[model samples]
Target: MSVDDGAVAIIGWDPSLVRETVARGLRPVLVRDVPAHLRGTSIPLPEETEEIVVEDITDVGDVWAGLTRHFGERLHQELRGIVTFDEFAVSTVAALTSLMNLPGSRLERAVLMRDKHLQKQAVLAAGVPAAASRLVVPGSERIRTPFPGPCVVKPVAGGGTAHTEMVRTEAEYEALLNKLALSATSPFVVEDLVDVAQEWIVDGVMQDGVVVFSSVGRYAAPCLSYTTDAEPLHIYRVDGTGEDERCAEARAFAGKALQALGYTDGVFHLELLLDRSSDTFFFGEVAARVGGCLIQEAVLLKHDFSLAGGAVDVALGRPVQSTSETTDRCVATTSLHLPRGTVVRLPNSGRFAAADDIHEVRVAVLLGVNDHPEVRATTNWQGLALVSAASLAELDARMAAVRGEFIEQSLVAPTFGTGVQQRAFLADYEDAWRRLL
Candidate 1:
């Protein structure tokens, strides 16, 4: 079948991605939630979109019914593949692809990636090194950790470190459980925390169970640290050919882990924890979609290719060109977060954008004077920036400068009453500015 003969169903609303897919010769069929698509964004759909079907993207049965009702008999002939950029819709897209007999990640593989326990079991069974973990069901008898020392507890099926915590003693564990119980996010996974010196993220594209393109990035700080710490999260790309030992090792490990998980096609985001003392790497987790934040933009800037476009190609069963040839330039993506308080001033984005190294400046939240920022236990950022430099040291300096400037110009006043929570917030707010200098 030719690329122009059938359409690919994209399960989220991204106008720019739709335009990119259209430019590659495949028609796009959008699938979105009725309430979210109508209320979420003000941007209109692209003219290249063939058709859009609205349903609860979280409900696989509703989405299946909606797709069937819209296409009827043409579902088989018109639909080439099903894909999604949203983490919540990964399993839904996988199920639909299986039902439609289209090309995409299998349902079982998707399930393994979605559930933390299952993912660890699959990888360990295949002789991959990973942290030992066990499942925790709500209302069940309290289970002790298999390994001693500090352990991490988090939702069995979630991302972005929301509600993830590290507990050392029984009192802390009990407190965490009570906190989680009130929130109703249960079925947690408790794993022994690795003595990690640094964390690395591997973003790549796979075709027919083989890796085609891969890149390695070193995180300045672990993503989990951002939830309580004041440091900005930065990921600087490792530049060089496959001969670079660290980059090669990370890429190889990522490929082996993805293969063990039964991921055959599409883009993948994998994380690995490094123990510098022993020169060992531990499997953190993997996702079936593009890495969140500015990962896609970083890949495009360094590799001169589009991961979004690659996902569209893989979904449509088109041959993917290898991204082995890179610009050999240093690029990094930084996410800046604000303390929980009322906004007194906003940062000057134009000043950051004027720098030669700065490629893009994105402000997610627009807070005016006296507006309280949204509070959450996650790595949600208020703004993001993309920068490129000639060397790693230069990249770090530029990132530090940008981060320092943003915090200095933006002022947030504490609105919460005097309490432990308010005191902690104020401490983080002050420390964030102090560390920048």
Candidate 2:
């Protein structure tokens, strides 16, 4: 398992992750799509990268050809591991891992992590508590409603909440179908919308079928609220204390859910819906990669460890030093959003970065006057902030200050499209903001 001269084929280009891999004494072979790599920020790849396998990382044939051409018959020996931070490449990585006879999660388990319907079925069969879901093929005869009342409809294999919708009535469901314009081959899932009081995210690392590390964080508002209702998305790590029963419950549930899905090794990002009235936790979904947004950053601040580094170690079959520890320290992350509009002004990043409680601020979008920007439906953000506090009360206060003083005051934009009137849109925004508060 020593990685002195071993090379790990990373399926995406992330400079920080590449640096971590290099720091671990393993050479990094970047398998990236040229077009996608160009679309990202202009950060240079780490100089320590051993080789670049340029191809469509999501295509098995292309990746196989590229890797074989580069490594020739030494694919199994030279390449010690294959890994990816990209969600879309999870299944591809798994297939490549097996093809190369490398240590990694099985392809079947990776597929379960990718497809929501299959994931739910597997977990539920293993006695995990999860929302009941039914898969709907576009051309199939309509089946009877599996669950009554409000439900969530989403693509079987989707991310970032794109094309996800909440349907409360038959009319809404029909309208949603027309809106999505799904073809005969498209498949979707319909699941009961649990009355969720709080949504929790559990990020962890696994080694040889056992969870070696885990951390729980509660969202300020449900993820659906951000896209559907225009509420800001925020999450804070739960201070692992005995006072909060949900924190302990979430950690236990995440282990069970990962085991149910047959995810033996690698990292996992799992979501759980808390039904406060019933005191129950339901499996939301699980991904075979790190959670999106600033989750990795937040985890590092809270636990003093690197998930990216850990993923590399596990992939290379090197023993990972567990950094799991309980603490009262608080860390939080929030995504900054702006209403659909033409940007008139950009935010003041300096002010945010100066705040004592704010650890990091990232502005992703650059804008100028009169340029129309597409409305955000996914978790994409104009900016992201990571903040830390001494206590929950302090965290709340600091977050409120960020929302009201920094974020709300910084952006200036006017409604751009002809779809909704500016006045009505303002009213909706206000309502959503109030609900978030």
Q: Which parts of model 2 have CA positions greater than 4 angstroms off?
A: 1-4, 40-44, 50-55, 139-148, 182-185, 241-244, 324-327, 344-355, 368-378, 403-437
Query: Tens digits of per-residue lDDT for model 1 on 193-216?
Result: 787889998998888998888878
lDDT of 2 by residue, 121-231 (tens): 998999998888887754345743444568988888887776677778878876665555554345888898888888998998898998888888888887777666566
lDDT of 1: 0.78
Clashes (candidate 1): 0
Q: TM-score of each candidate?
A: 0.86, 0.86
In angstroms, the error of model 1 at 144 is 7.4
lDDT computed for candidate 2: 0.78
Deviation (Å) of 350 in candidate 1: 5.7
Among all windows of ten consecutive residues in candidate 2, which has the lowest summed lDDT?
369-378
lDDT of each: 0.78, 0.78
